[model samples]
Target: MEGMALNQLFGNAYFGRKVLVTGHTGFKGSWLCLWLTSLGAHVTGLALAPNTEPAHWSLLGLDEVHDLRVDLRDGQAMRQALQEVQPELVFHLAAQPLVRRSYRESLLTFDTNVLGLVHLLEAIRETPSVHAVVNATTDKVYAEQVIKNGYPEDHPLGGHDPYSTSKACAELVSDCYRKSFFFDGGPRTATARAGNVIGGGDWSEDRLVPDLVRAASTGSILQLRNPAAIRPWQHVLEPLSGYLRLGQALLAGEPVEGAWNFGPASDATLPVHALVSQIQAQWPGLRSEYLPGPHPHEAGVLQLNCAKAARELAWRPVWSAEDTIRHTIDWYRAYYASSRLLSSEDLQDYVAAAHNAGLEWAA
Candidate 1:
């Protein structure tokens, strides 16, 4: 079942609220900041400079908010920045979020994904104004078990690759902090493990949708490392809605803390080739070739059981896999053809569509 309206669910919880978003320059972070700003939240963003020249941060005009450029690995600097912001709600989304790149840059991946959380948690512990936190983690944190059913929230956490291992470690850190300190008087903390998310404005390299669209534009063959690998895919807003709902519950003093899975319905889990082929259908000329090459280890099949989120937060994915791919391809096609990036209008349109689809968050 769908959840309640955003206004009813939030009840002005975000209006005039002090919110801090780490990694605000990244893809999902930019979208979150935009949404929070629309809700009349006083948003402060802390992140490194955008990695890509044509990054979503600039495209979305995120500079309109309180944007600060800082390294999360620098504990003192992060602490100082958090102190200055003194936020009531914190959404931590900063991490080295690529699998192939993690193999080459293992040290940096661990440092940023794992140690970075440590720094942020330390800062949160000292920041008095923080009432709740939502830590964005990946579904890859689970141990790669060859199973068709989705991994539940209590699934044993394990990871083979550096990226996954570091995220698992981050989860452990959050658990420790939640039990040791936050349980008493510290800010409520929770970990959100979402599946592979695809949407507009995600220009990250080594990702499927971006790479496919880029290759199609140049008429180059789209070479996939694991074309047959299955993944739970959803539009970016799906899990983001879960995070916001979780945060709202926390602020309302509801017992909605700890680890949670915000994934798509089981039907959205599809192979990489299928995803590429679907996008090609929408755009009409995306040629792809599966080239067998040396690649780092990745889970052949991954899925998440979002029963907890649906039962507790009343959150469910609004878009189907086909709709998600279509939305993504259409955005990239328009952007490449006219350089018209996503704006508040597009955001409003998305929410309206979600509302039409009976999504509670959009209501």
Candidate 2:
């Protein structure tokens, strides 16, 4: 199943009405913003400058959005920006999203991940149209002393590292706002936890895919942080679809509530070598030799029981692991083939269709 047409997505009687996307310039955020536009939603984006040079936000040409570059940590600035957007749906994704980076800069990660979420929640209280929000958290939000078959939402919230810890804190903040404030009169906020997402245009360092792709491109060996470690690897679109569908259900004031996981089913859990081999198979000339390296602390065998999401949100990853790699590699190959950066249109259409496909399968 591919994505529904733009009209089918937004034309659902209860369309966007008004929407705002925070951190619209990051990898996941950029994809979310593009989907909103494709579905005919009026979107406003607020985030600090794009984190990467060939930033995903700029690469997606979000200049078409009512784009505002502002620091999320700046409470006043964030509040003012949200007041103007007056969104009916706000997606909070602005944060320091890397675990290793958090170790290098723990305070900054906490400020951006924790405080930034607070700013958005407060902003939504003032904005009338903001009826629903989907706050993005990571699978790392759970207290992972060990890897159960799959960690459920009820698992205690804990973090082994700063990034994971901060995301858990963010979830707590969202839960507080949703229960304490939204109970009577406030935006109905739902938190989303997703697994390791790999896809096109993700050039972040310390990530397995990015590092693997970068090394393969240069004919250099990839140094994996923890090769034997396992993760719930799914295409980026899978979890994103869960986010959009969750937001839609929330806006409709459905019985949907609380946190959910959007990730591949158990079969989708593949190791670093499997992912690397799949990616290299698609793009020849990719050579990888594992060198011993230690990365900032990260979970060893993190898996999420996405059964909750599948049961509630009706979401499941549509693409096979091979498909995820093929699509991801294809994007990089196409960009190099054309000798031009991927246009916002190209990226949006591809990922949107992927999301629609997941939605159809879930249905």
Candidate 3:
């Protein structure tokens, strides 16, 4: 069940279809571009330059496709790009996506995460060929609650930090667009909310898995910001799989509404220390210590209840927390070792594993 073929679930729907992926130079978008290319989709990417070296886009050789370096904030350029591509399916993933960074650059964060989405939606409205859209948002969009239960899609949308708040605003923008313009006989638009995604090829600053991988490679003493913080963690592939499924439904003229959550199973929400230790065990003699420091307000405990996605889209996570960590470790280890293996190779192997795991969506 873990070795399912990628095409089995999507079929020939993507073949020859013009697809536009914003933020294609980033981690998640790069992976999606690769998968779309493999599905025989005509893929075009729009993004600012990659901030980090050895990014996933470069790793997968995404430049061979239609890669355009563009900022999401420039609405005119974005609109022009959309008209040029004439995409049938659009996946919106561009944003300023870090919490601490958002604290320092509050205006930039809001402009990118909130207004950038507005620009994208406006472009989609002007482009008539685009029939389906999935705007990738974060689980942090939910306001902090006193309870430990996972947050459902209908939960009060709020955020303590700028990054989360901007995403919540983005959700509101999408909802307004859906109701105001796309209410009937227009493009099907939806937002996907996912939590603390971990995977290979992610070198973003202040992220957990990437920090751990870097420390393990360099034998550096890794400093922990908040070891007790708990989050709903899932493999990157898990939510990307959900996005594809949602796109399929929208393309088929299914009337989906508002936002959806695709999070890890109930028990996969673990403390930061536990997840760090799990990956640490894979690297012998790796030293790490928790150093309590003053940090901005981040959620101590966050989770998502994906019952809507389960019931409506029939989508659920395929990898357990432990398996996610293991696969992440394997990819980074092979990556640092430069053992004559490409990340694209690792991706193919992961898809096979997901198929074998009996993930119906992957099938």
lDDT of 3 by residue, 239-340 (tens): 888898888888987767579998986657999998888887877767789888787889998988888898888788877887788777888888788733
Against the true structure, candidate 3 reaches a TM-score of 0.95
Q: List the global CA lDDT of all models.
A: 0.85, 0.77, 0.84
lDDT of 1: 0.85
Top lDDT prediction, candidate number: 1
- What 10-residue stretch in candidate 2 is worst by lDDT? 7-16
CA deviation > 4 Å runs, candidate 3: 1-5, 339-342
Q: What does candidate 2's lDDT look like per residue over 1-363, in tens digits?
A: 234445355225224467788888888888877767766678888887776666666766756589899998888887888777777888888889988889999999999999888887887777777788888899999887665668888989998899999999999998898888888767787889999988777888788888876876677877666777788888777777788888878877787779988878567787777777777778777776666665567677888887777776666667777666777777776755674554344445445555566564233
Query: Which scores higher on lDDT, 2 or 3?
Result: 3
The TM-scores of all predictions, comma-separated, are 0.95, 0.91, 0.95
Per-residue lDDT tens digits for candidate 1, residues 121-193, read 9999999999999999999999878755689988899999999999999999999999998988889999999
> Candidate 3, after superposition: displacement of residue 118 in Å?
1.2
